[model samples]
Target chain A: MKNNSLPTDVEPAKTDPRIKLITAKIKKENYKPDALIEILHTAQNAYGYLPMNVLKFITKALHLPPSRVYSTVTFYHFFSLKSKGEHTCLVCTGTACYVKGAQLILNEIEKQFSLKPGQVSADNKLGVSVARCIGACGLAPAVVLDEEVHAKVSSEEIVNSINAKIAV
Target chain B: MPKISVTIDDKKLDVDVGKTILEVCKENGIEILTMCHLKGLTDVGACRLCLVEIEGVNKLLSACTTKIAANMIIRTKTEKIKRYQRITSELFFAERNHVCSVCVANGKCDLQKLGYKTEMNHIRYPYLFPECNVDTSHPWYVLDHNRCIMCTRCVRACGEVEGAHNWNVMNRGYQVRIISDFDTPWGESVTCTSCGKCVHACPTGAIWPKAIVQGQLEKKPEIIGELVEKRKMNL
Candidate 1:
């Protein structure tokens, strides 16, 4: 058993191998402007979300204004500044799906979970969002839960599906 | 220029070799409504508003993107085409905060103009006005996430045209938004030149000149096309 094992330093120690590896890579790149996207991608992958210090380090290294880096991240939907849920559900509400009662299916799920689309469930079980079209119009009124797609769904089916997943 | 004949609204016409059906129609005084595909930017083919039926092509092709082929048969203003365009326009209005009366780009906006041309009435679809924020932190421009159509015209203008690469679009599907650098605030983003070209390229009020009065918005005509031509000359 270790006594007084709490870390005194708030920051991760320089001796930590992860930090050293990142620093070595940064040194090798010497921070070109073109590498801004790559660095941000690496930082987000490593740290989950970009912290202020990481952004600052990127700013200095890339010789780019902090605004430029921040804008690129915000402009494209591929990157996330905030930590997202492990599971994301995308429902199709395109014209084809809309005609087939896609809205009702989404409403039913939201009512059952008290979670709006784009909101993570209180238990962090799911994050839901409505997509314009997921290229599955033939499967109209489709509700995609994580990687699985449920088609021709009723309100009851949505509720049961959620309950079943939750029970599991 | 080589000549190619095509039909528009069932009227046959001979057009230049390499021009799109849209360009042919425009030259012959035909009106086709669009929002996303600007003359200057590389055709994105996202809107699907410009879709027309070609005799041989089974799938509807974007008039703006598809170049004219010799003796190509085409049909415009068909019931199918009208329905598709109307639905797409309705979706555009429903997805964003396009409350025209209060919007800065009310009269002058391309989306509004498209709505006018299409005679879009009563969005049959439900609204998805996601709770987006307004960033006035940028000294010269206001970035309203609600009004953005996600056309990426502004993004293209910033990166490809202005060569700033300050703006980008974040997320997939409905959660997507135009992000300045690193998903930070507009003022905080480093790549923004504050050139205001993005504001010009935006078809809606998503990116607008700061405090543009109710009756004061006017779109610059042919600026993007002119700029593209100028750039091509330089290249």
Candidate 2:
């Protein structure tokens, strides 16, 4: 049977600063396997998404199995295996938001940019997604553009905002 | 090991303390419907079919995971449990494409047996019909996502018995999937030993040998528990 362990001496590419950041975080955690989730959080924050190679690095460093690492990464919603693109449009489809035409905003965005929820544009400029709720229910039919909440905005206004950001 | 008294379906009996309600019921020949449960493997209680109502407890607990307690009053065949089991069976059918007529495990599938046991006449909920992939990447086995019930039996069997954690669950909710090593193709899995333990662990046609055809697939899930027992004998 083949050994699944990687040599401790083998390190990830030294040129990438993001790797250095992850290595530092792992070191800070003392390379304890129990801190796997904490280490994953640092890696995700550095790379915006958990890339395969980075995941492999963590697996090797923690002396954990590949499936263990991958399973943990895939379980949580906060972690993303794929990039969320340069600009993101997150529409809230909570009971309150859906009651106030949240689906219409989603439709308008899909019509304008040809991007559906959980889909990224071919150019990788814009990505669209939906949330159950962001707890901003008072702002019914709310849309989030690049981490900034656009409260009570019409579908046309949201589309124009996305166009303005991604066009640049 | 002292025995404890418990009343199950109005039948009072003295059973072992550490044994689960399901284990006690099974030993005593009390019928309790279950899925996602296999002997000799760890009990995860993923399937809610084994739910039994306990006196003073508001919610029904799974028999497989809940241990028997002293002077406990347990009811397994209540009308509420029957209703829930039927609902669960219907949801399992409606969640994916379980076209039994075309399935390889058609007549022998546990899911089909479960439907019969629960008396599932027809599904009321709309079928999700999510486009699932059938991975024929392995040289000897095939992994069909459509037939999967998200039971972690294969995952546990691979990890605990085979000592190869090749199988793992990815994503969540309706989008959950059984992925092989970083969601890559099974044939390309660096960790998989191709032991075929997962084939036996699977309760559905989600994983099966490539050689079999419709209704011809034979699975010996009992071998897994027997294997564990035999290993303890050190023969």
Candidate 3:
């Protein structure tokens, strides 16, 4: 006889170690709904981006509606629903950076890689994004490549750096 | 409830203290324009159409959210307020694809009526023709993001009245959107009860039933307030 019923012993806690970290954080916060943003920060760090299954698990643990959790997650800029690729290039486009040559850098990168802001490459190797400012006005026209900030960069320099990172 | 004396547009009136300026204005037959405010739902003051000039305050305040205080001198009809209202109406038109000629809520839309009320003849700002999606996933309803002004009335009506938190706003700034269950299709939503409260709550043609075509959509937003009042009587 075919066993139509699924196995009851399979648990996400045993398969994924990241779920344990989230569970520990939830417990540390006493499952309080006010701690949702803090818990989401931890979950985003673990998964790189928030997945649907993880959101459902968090919603269930917190006893909140799915829409409430989803709304909070999408309201903030720090959280992301999709993967930001393995390597990221964040260009500053604030008033200071825009006064410098930030747009030129963006144009050069688009010409070289054919990837616009908020777009990932075909192979998922690099993602390009633009931020209003990183509060580094002194370093105008700055580009953050994989968490490392390059200050006062020209279009050619940014292109070279992105090429080096993508090549790796 | 205690009464407070307030002068609105040079008219003296003694009204209830806890009520908002909009409420007091409505009771006194003073015209104050509003779009995001539905009587039953909690006032978010999202739309800036109901701004009124209060004495001693440099900045204009929204009438819907600002409660009436003792001896508060308010001016609902002013040259400055009219200019701001016109600018707001223009911005609303420029922000989205509000082409009323082919819209479902053409003559009946609140935004169109607001434009006429504010004397908005032309839009000064450049139109941002951003690509928007029309989600027809729900069996009975459709959510067209093109005509949305981000008033959030539907979001509040779904959560507060229907008790089904299926609709929510996602993202921020120009990219903000109303999502159904984790940004999935509405038909695939697990939380939505499909009570159609949002359809009636929407002031624009952004949300409508599937059966209705353009220019035939009718909404009864008063039903939300009536339902809330009925619930209070039962309790």
Clashes of each: 30, 0, 0
Candidate 3 TM-score for chain A: 0.86
**Residues B82-113, model 2: lDDT tens digits:** 99999999999999899888899988899999
Write model 2 residue lDDT over A46-118, tens digit each, in one string: 8767777788889989988787888798798898878777898899999999999999999998899888899
Return the TM-score for each candidate structure. Answer: 0.66, 0.85, 0.85
* lDDT accuracy of residue B3 in candidate 1: 72
Better of 1 and 3 by TM-score: 3
Q: What DockQ do you compute for every candidate structure?
A: 0.19, 0.36, 0.35
The docking quality of candidate 2, as DockQ, is 0.36
Best by DockQ: 2
| Model 3 per-residue lDDT at A12 | 50
* Alpha carbon deviation, residue B2, candidate 2 (Å): 2.3
- Model 2 residue runs over 4 Å out of place are A1-12, A89-132, A136-168
Error of 2 at B217 (Å): 2.5
